[model samples]
Target: RAAATSRRLSHSQYASTTSGGPLQEAFAKGALKPGLNVVLEGRPKQPNDVEGLKQCLAEFRQQLAWVERLDVTLGQLTNVVESVSQNTTDKDAVDPENDFQREMSFYRQAQAAVLEALPRLRKLKVPTRRPDDYFAEMAKSDQQMQKIRQKLKSKQEAMEKSEKAKQLRAMRKYGKKVRRSYKRDISMTRMWSLSEELRN
Candidate 1:
């Protein structure tokens, strides 16, 4: 634009300033230094300086064309960048592997929990062996028990003499079965241990 405006204005300004026309020829002869003139290196002296104007214009048009191509390339680059960014966003929103990964992580946590509880499971396990003196240790002291026949004879004598003893025996006609009917709060593991010890 600067080149075009200067080209046109130089012609008009010269025409206006040199209306007398002889001053124009004298100024040309003076060989003044050029300022802001769009000069094409060569010109046709005989026909006119018209060829110089055409050359300068052709060069300017070529430069403008190069600028237009750069703008087109920049637009294409912007579109490519936008497409890549949109694809990345879509991938982040949903993916098939995420569910599988979460399930695997949950399974891993369950496995770790089981592993951590192994020592407690071992501690809860019922013991298989009973000591050699188990029955000896379980028996009452000698004062609490004597020969079975002798004890029974004494009991029978007492029951016959004591009215209270006779009435107690009559009331207990169901015998040990009534005591067996009641439930105990003992755990299965403890029962298992007892049964194992008494297996012999």
Candidate 2:
């Protein structure tokens, strides 16, 4: 009889407290505890009352099982959300590969421009007689500067080629004598003679 009454009273309490903020607050703070009662004192229990008590206990256990399942589902959802967020952030932080490719592309363009200018540079003219005084006579415009630079580059290349040709000719002529003179490098005297001949 007591257990049956207790269940009924508990249901009534749940209904009354459903929209009560203080009741929820108290439960959260552990000021309330849920329980099932079977009897109060020595008394012959009613069969109908025992059945009612059984029903209440069954319902309470089922509600608890539902809450536990919801908790587990929520925990799994939180882990999935955290993993997705980290992957997105890491992708944003990563640098792109195209930056290196873009730099290499710029370098290739610069190299091509230099190679294409070389042939045009070779045919340009420069006066060899007044090498030091040429800059003073050249005009100070972009076109004039470019033309002068091309002429100077061509003259310098021709001079270097001519000098190399002369060296090869001299080596062919005196190479046998130079080798017979010493097993080591050419002596100081030979080097001086070579310098004077180049200067002349």
Candidate 3:
């Protein structure tokens, strides 16, 4: 009896706390009842971090105006689009299914980009060409490459030698068969002449 009374007191306290809401009015009218699945609203949201947002925007603007500024020409973009449109119109001239046309299209676009970019880079005073005295380090040492070439050459030579040997063996076998057949034919002819001479 005491436990039942404690539960009723707790339920009344919960009901009082949720009294003014539409859900409580629905419960009062016996239209809807609260269950374990029923969810209540959480606490209101906290204020946004305005200072942090300002700092982030300032940083973004600084980065955008950095030493290496990005410049996109509307004219160049339009030219590229026009070129693509023209290329598409001549689909019959260059097969759409062929990879050659696709590759060529990419090459032309890249060429145009390079042509446009070079002038801008020069204007910006950026180095557009490598120095004559610039030396590039190769992935493999000269000695290692030479060794690889030697190995490949030796393999090729071995293959050629084996092929020659095989051809020679086949020729010797064929020649031996031909010599035997010729010798047999000659002996038979000689025997025929001897038989004729005996009869005479």
Candidate number of the best TM-score? 3
| Index of the highest-lDDT prediction | 3
Give residue 110's error in model 2 in angstroms: 45
List the pairs of residues colliding in candidate 3. Answer: none
Measured against the true structure, the TM-scores of the candidates, in listed sequence, are 0.15, 0.20, 0.37
Which candidate order results from sorting by TM-score in descending order? Answer: 3, 2, 1
The lowest-lDDT stretch of 10 consecutive residues in candidate 1 is 67-76
* Backbone collision tally, model 1: 0
Predicted structure 3, TM vs. truth: 0.37
Which parts of model 2 have CA positions greater than 4 angstroms off?
1-139, 178-200
Q: For model 3, state the Cα shift of residue 164 in Å.
A: 1.7
Candidate 1, 65-183: lDDT as tens digits: 42234231111233323333455455223234556544544455555555555554556563435788676453766656666667998998887879777777877865655554543
- Note the clash tally of each candidate: 0, 0, 0
Q: Which 10 consecutive residues of model 2 have the lowest summed lDDT? A: 67-76
Q: What is the lDDT of residue 190 in candidate 3?
A: 96
In candidate 1 the C-alpha lDDT for residue 155 amounts to 93
